[model samples]
Target: MNSYSIPRFTMVLAGVLMGCLAMAAPDQPPVSAEKADERAGALLAKMTTEQKLELISGHNQFFIKGFPELGIPQLYMSDATQGVHIRPQLSNQLEKSVAFPAPIALAASWNPDLAYAYAKAVGEECRAGDVAVLLGPGMNIYRVSQCGRNFEYFGEDPYLIARMVERYVRGMQDTGTMATLKHFVANNTDHRRRTSNSIVDERTLHEIYLPGFKAGIDAGALAVMTSYNQVNGEWAGQSRAVITDLLRGQLGFKGLVMSDWTSVWDAEKIIKSGQDLEMPGKANIVKDAARLLAEGKVAMADVDRMARSILRTCIALGLHDRPVKDERFLAKFADHESVALQSAREGVVLLKNNGVLPLAPKGTGKILATGTFMEKLPRGGGSADVLGYNAVLLKQAIAETYGERVTFVAEPTDEQLKAADVVLLSTGTLDKEGADRPFALAKADEARVQRAVSLNPRTVVIVNSGGGIQMTDWNEQAAAVVYGWYPGQVGNRALVEVIAGLTNPSGRLPITIERRFKDSPGYGYVPAGEDVGKGLKRGEEMAKPVYPIEYKEGVFVGYRWYEAKKIAPLYAFGAGLSYTTYAYGQPVIAKANAKRGEAVTVTCTVHNTGKVAGAEVVQLYVRPAKAPVPRPEKELKGFAKIPLAPGEVKTVTFTLNPRDFAYWDVARHDWSVAPGRYQVLVGGASDRIAGEASVTLE
Candidate 1:
């Protein structure tokens, strides 16, 4: 069982320069399952029990005796989720991979094609770097803001994350490399991540968290990495319900399932649950597992089965031979970097638009772009911080555009604010070593912004935040406001373009930017200490669930909480502005009565009535007309972003099913819908409902 003696299956397969064209529709059915099984069994018969254990227990390092005689190439993997980490050692690596706008930024763009294009570029880097598997594309729902990796994941809604993730998987795999969809199943929060248990309702599990992982699997993800946290009390890495039952049995995931770095605890539990590999380094628990197999504690066949699974995965990835590399191939891969920049640009949400931008007449007003936040602010801190290349700041871009006219008043001098025609201030926190962001604006900047706005009412503020922040104050002082999250390299350019009116601002709020932390869903009830039964305990247990965050504003989670009980946020989810004004005609429901899987098309005629040509996101919300269960006032079922020219009119439509309007019923362990009237409203923002229609689900 020498590492170098493994066998390789080399079959020439045609591929595209961009990536593999979608695997041709099963040209001749796949190697029959029965035959493949037999082949696997025969391979297993040749391997010694010890050898089988080695294959499943630890990874064979690259270029070593991976298979000394068998000539099987040991696959090399690199962290290229956001950008390629070329250096092997932690210290040798860049500050971090490029802190690109989180995936939610891309999802906000509402362009799956853009995501695919970005991932394709990521694939090229993987091939160039000689890495076989690119551990990327973390597609999870940002169910709550407290999740430490929130900035690394896609957003709140399942459909939004799933659609984008599927495209990313296809794009990465298409490029002749494997993409690993990560942190599977209810692994949202990062608080005490290594040992934290996510106690989620089962229905919420299926409807929200599981959908994205399923979609990625369906799209042919080469691997799925288990999360660090526990799901429904069982560790995600060792949960049979999550791995074998749901992923393999229900979703039909045929790829490798590996654990997060240093995430495995009980080795036998994980192996039985279908986890194919342990990461970073093989743990001591694995050695114990080896001893268990040698004894009667675990079966020898179990090791053989895991070994076969790993081999199958390797064969599927085509890593059995020397990788074919060409200069032309390298050149094609370079296009990927640009694709990343472009995708990042598209993902930049334009929170507000006024006549002041694509800069009215370019140099009409002397623009003052200033702020310490713009100069040094990074994306979300801690694990999510990608230390790598990114774009210049808004101040730099603005100066480049206007030269002397665009004075980047670093600290906003009194004379500068007085002289400036318009003030554009960039402000927010960087990803730092804090447990969580305190609920307040940076005091110094807040004071500076107030002073600047008072000096010039024509001021516009661009907040570079990864999550919601306190914006209730100083909002009215500014003429226009924009929430520009960690938009990557071309981020500043994208912001400039959106502000200057070059690109239409279609990016909507993926997470609600609540006025205060007290307005969040996890506000009062999130358990801390031992009472919740998990997470890092401090000194001692409190009397009740010690909510570090007290719920001052109860029941106000997002736009629902705001609209439901008449509370107002600085901005609402699905709220963003365009340079042009859009008029929404009342929506007409084609089918007043629809079946479970039937599509309910809500159609509305939208007209661009403003001077500028722009894009408008027509949001479709579904509300239970007669609810037996508590529900959000209206949930986003479907939405369409349409481009319209000045005075141009277009009919935009959204289709939904019973599932889209249904509530996750934990009691029945399924998604259920009330067969009654459901309201379908179409509009720009959550507060601005311009069109409405009623449909009955039968």
Candidate 2:
């Protein structure tokens, strides 16, 4: 982050009078809904039925069909959960891109403003590729620790995920590039994702799962991509209950709804379900839709709706009028890399520190770098693996930071371990799309880590993972522990800076790290699978569940389950330490009593009590002192990130709405707040509460 500087105002009043005027005049304001519909309608009228059908499907693997004769530009799309996964050019050369930290990493930062900056940079990358729609900002709630796709999403809390998703959607669309909120609803685990059915209750769906999607839609996301799995016995892409009723009706999303590649089953059902687009250009959609319409299996009105959805989005976003491709941003990616570096700096969680971090400046001693990802920039496999341009590996960063003092060793002997001043064990396993990562590190990694920890207590272990991993094996013996989630491209530089004391670690754990995998709510819930459907895509398809994978834990995911069941985890949600310390003063409630639909304000003062300047993430947890129904101990309602110099204190204020205190009423089919006493807890993490106050809600 220090390597890049923020752009300053250019005293543009001198030149911007002409430049700004030119820009302001040429670019028309965003068309209203009525205007967008009229424009789309005019274009739709010019196209034939075949052309309309083509508009609803992809032309190439990542492009939408466009008519050059009609002056429409073919729009490209890309997989962009982490960064722009730039497609290969016609020459088959991969396009270079700046890789930002994973979504979970950004979520860990707990800075919505940073989330906006992180996403805006990525949106710029989308423009560089001329990608009209970015198949990203996947906000599915993290359900299991072993979920492979967790890195692509925010953590397990609905409120936290919603806040991040809202910012990300706004940031991407604000760049004039469309953002797609993806894997709509309950896409927790990637294992058997194509076939597994997530059996979630209505209340759990609304309370724990739907908030993130709703936030994205409310933020003006232009598109949504359907999940590959089934929900309540029907494929999510072809479920009217999920698409038409839940997404469009309840969430009020009127965007283009596209299915995951090869995810659609019955064309007739998809047409009726409001799946506006089938991706990767499937032939069955065109061929079967003709017959379905002729046989009255599908309505012409629904088909028109689907095609109109695509056209409306294109017209509304001005994608139909402008060239989708622009290489201008590629030259400016150094600025984006700095954003990635800043995200990594803010997201690296100092899990444990026994005065071993920020090791004695220049006298830190011979740094021993070892791990599976020592030489490679670890990333989630599949689409999230954006080949980072100028990505710094852990070893590379360590060497760059420490110079001649750094040494590379896969396995150090007892003598070597004893000889080194510090053992920097940079360890993590690569995550794949369809496979679930183990809750524990690999046996070989465990042994090496344990050996290093046992021999050299100065061992500073850096773990790169999507979520929690088995740390109990040797974490206690290690002098310090850091959870550096997939830091993108130049993100390793930030990690090194934190270790070098140049940057104070401020990230909090987005998800809880359980002491044991079995201690999780989803433990022993692995579905046994068999391929029942013919022509299932790949060999991995055999893992598809024949029976529904029940979410018996319901709304109690992550810290909620731990707090509710009284099972202690290795680390709590929102848990992370910093080089400096912070003290939270007693919270002041603006009002002792509150009614429905009113905002209640809470303020707390925080002081940087330590010697170093650092940032503190002030967390606000809302709890019902007495409730009529079952709920978790506390839920995250509001939060703020405050930076202070040593001895400096700042007061942070948070506003709470009725929805933050309400729970989904299953019987009433609406959110309801039972009249009760509520406690407001403010602190750094869920378990690290420092101050509390009470409020009455009637």
Highest lDDT, which number? Answer: 2
TM per candidate: 0.85, 0.94
How well is each residue in 555-625 modelled by candidate 1, as lDDT tens digits?
23356566776766667777776656789899998977887667788789999897766667788888888
Best by TM-score: 2
Where model 1 places Cα greater than 4 Å from the true spot, the runs are: 1-42, 58-68, 88-100, 321-329, 353-355, 380-391, 432-435, 524-566
Deviation from native of the Cα of residue 122 in model 1, angstroms: 1.5
Error of 2 at 292 (Å): 0.7
Candidate 1 CA-lDDT value: 0.65
